[model samples]
Target: MKSDHSIPGTEEAPELSYRILSDTSSSAPVIVFFTSAVVWLLVGTVFGLIASFKFNFPDWLGNIPALTFGRVRPAHLNSVIYGWASLGIAGLYVWLTARLCQTEVHWRRLLYISAILWNAGVLYGVVSILGGHSQGIEWLEFPKGAQTLIAMASVLLSLSILRTFYGRRVKHIYVSLWYILASVIWFPILYVIANLPFYSGVTQAAVNWWYAHNILTVWVTPAGLAAAYYFIPKVIGRPIHSYYLSLLGFWSFALFYNWNGIHHLIGGPLPTWLISVSIVASVLMFIPVITVAINHHLTMVGHFGKLRYSPTLRFVVFGAMCYTAVSFQGSIQALRSFNEITHFTHYTVGHAHLGLYAFFTMSIFGAIYYIMPRLTKWEWPYPVLIKFHFWLVALGITLYVISMTVGGFIQGLYMNDPSRPFMDSVQVTKPYLMARSIAGVVILIGHLFFIYLFYLMIKRKGVKRLTPPWYEKAEEYAR
Candidate 1:
């Protein structure tokens, strides 16, 4: 039963490598962050479903102020972005940084405190938004009180990361570490500038887009890409296609994405030159996107078989593919002609989910699948459940994106047609809106199953077996 593959000691290497890569010092903090992130994932899913339904069934929860569309929509956005995505990214980077550096975390206490405060701050922010205390900024809807606490939490977490890097055992920092560090450092600066109350009128609008778009490009994109860079090679037991290409991708992305946000203000009161520059930056994003995509795909070449045996590879590869699709789509969407039609449509919502859920969330899910077993010393209990979770979400998001994208395109066309009545466009969206709601329910089902699976993993109550859950061939060789 020895491996037919060329890599010598393929069976033993994973176990040995995992032992070396796992961070015992930061396990507690990582667990806390992941647990909280899952809790928020559930919360945000429910809120998203409620918001979707309000589109077609306006009276479903109309009686309650907090459940109203205005409130619920923001609640959904904030919960997922801050509560789920942020925490998940934090947990991932901490584990990944420690693993890559070949050292344990330095300021463990700081990470612990930050986890507590970060959750509290997010909870307070969601509550305040529901209570009608929104800051009235798109992504900055959290009240000042909540923003302040979250900002403080971010500072603590950033410092903890720096401290970890300070005591690193690796002689050379890996590419993943670079992305993680940039995200941590960029976040607080972005947060502080975006939340400052001094700007007004058009200036404020510009600042809002700057913050929102940069959060996606600078903060979340790096985290997801870093995980992709690490896990693709790790799972396949191959080096990245080109280390030099990866560096070019990272720095180019950092330089270009900062100016990309102003594209969101196209046709607004902003100066024409500013909007044009943003469009140029958005197009320039293709350089990095293509470079990284090539690097990942080349590394994954000839390892397509691994997807069947490695749940981690499946999810990570799906996310990596989506990253390419979404980024290219984003560049096209940023063009003036394209933006004019889709800017105010549900198309943008689909686009956001493409980036957030398909790319970032899925990558993180794959990461958790790989790391959780390493942490708990038990493999996933049921491959069926993992398969179920994967398909349910994959199908749900597919349906969600198709419906919204087509519906938004129709609505946009209708809006531009002066001959058509405005309400007609609104009516055209009803069916798609319902599809979105149904898609939410489908995704929620998958999420619930995921949480239950995580519970089983934590309690060590899964099926009894000696082999890695996904890679049974390994056990054959080991025996």
Candidate 2:
């Protein structure tokens, strides 16, 4: 595919010139964020595998405090969420904001500082969690000092991004920018409020869920969605199927997602109206989900064949489809009846992976696959390895989610039946837990391949590409 970076109908010389300038300006900070994110991805994967295996071999590491399931599981979560996902998103924000804005990134030095502080915060928080210094809140388990560092890093990063956005030369902002802009603005406020020391008791629980859910909505989800919006059409060489639909999707998502988190508190001691409103918002999520699905799907209806050659398109389209599936599943999950069955079960675990790993992580993977080459000006060294990485993670997540959902449903059924002993629930989930462990192993192998490929690309060990890798013959479709 031709590397056309101009807006449709606005493919002027200045736009093309600015695209090159933007890439050059954003390259260093982008690479730093991605490199840090990959390191964390490896760390998180190891932690996750340990956590998964402990279910089947509970005593294997039972003697080690840091290796125990409690510490390992949360460590896995924080590593991936704060470290891998957040860092990757930061890199994408730097690149995408510059590209969309038609300007070089601003305050480049601050972005480098932000990267350092972010990594330091994650490192300190992970150590503190393993050392039993956890704050005990779900997502905010990071100690106060660690949270402060992350919050400060986020502010610095936001300053750079907002400054770039302000300096944009474009007459019209793109859809991706809207999400990027919203996320940077929303996250620091959410992070700071959630980390405040005063919340306790039931109020703490409420704030915990609020922050847990909103972090995904306002931070990660927007970045993931922005990637899908940008990469899908960019790779396919077409504009999005519907710009108005994209706006509708964005606004509705912003309106409904914040409220949907309270649905996690359905069975808790929260106020009836609070839970009721959350349920309503969750159900209303269908509006945005459907609109996004239509926009992405219709955009790719005829370009499915491109997935054969473009690793970026394959991962992104997979992620976009999963975004639809997971969002719909989330809407169903918020209902009182479904939540009753799946609330505390491994089904929720399956659901979270479907959204986070399958949707968001894969989207980031696709973005990196596309963005890294442009920044580094190197082709992927091993096409076969890319294929292997894709199938491994794809099949791995499929098995993982299937086993957890099916097993957790049975486990839930057993628990709900008072006639059956609680042990029955535990016993029934063993096989599925084993399946999840196997899946983790597969995904870990994929990450290893990806990390190697990334290293090769960064070191410029690969053959230089004369053109972008389009599946089959390169065909330039109209923007």
Which candidate comes out best when scored by lDDT?
2
lDDT, candidate 2, 1-479, per-residue tens: 23244433334355665676687678889999999999999999999999999999999978988888999888999999999999999999999999999888899999999999999999999999999988888888999999999999999999999999998888789999999999999999999998878877888888899899999899989999999999999999999999999999999999999988788888899888988998999999999999999999999998899999899999999999999999999999999988888888999999999999999999999999999977877789989999999999999999999999999999988989999999999999999999999999999999999999999998999787564333112122211
Model 2 residue 394 lDDT score? 99
Checking candidate 2 for backbone clashes, the offending pairs are none
Clashes of each: 0, 0
After superposing candidate 1 on the true structure, give the runs of residues whose Cα lies further than 4 Å from its correct spot.
1-22, 463-479
| Model 2 per-residue lDDT at 178 | 94
lDDT of 1 by residue, 66-170 (tens): 888999999999999999999999899889887886656768898888988899999999999999999888999998888998899899989988888886655
TM-score of 1: 0.93
Every model's TM-score: 0.93, 0.95
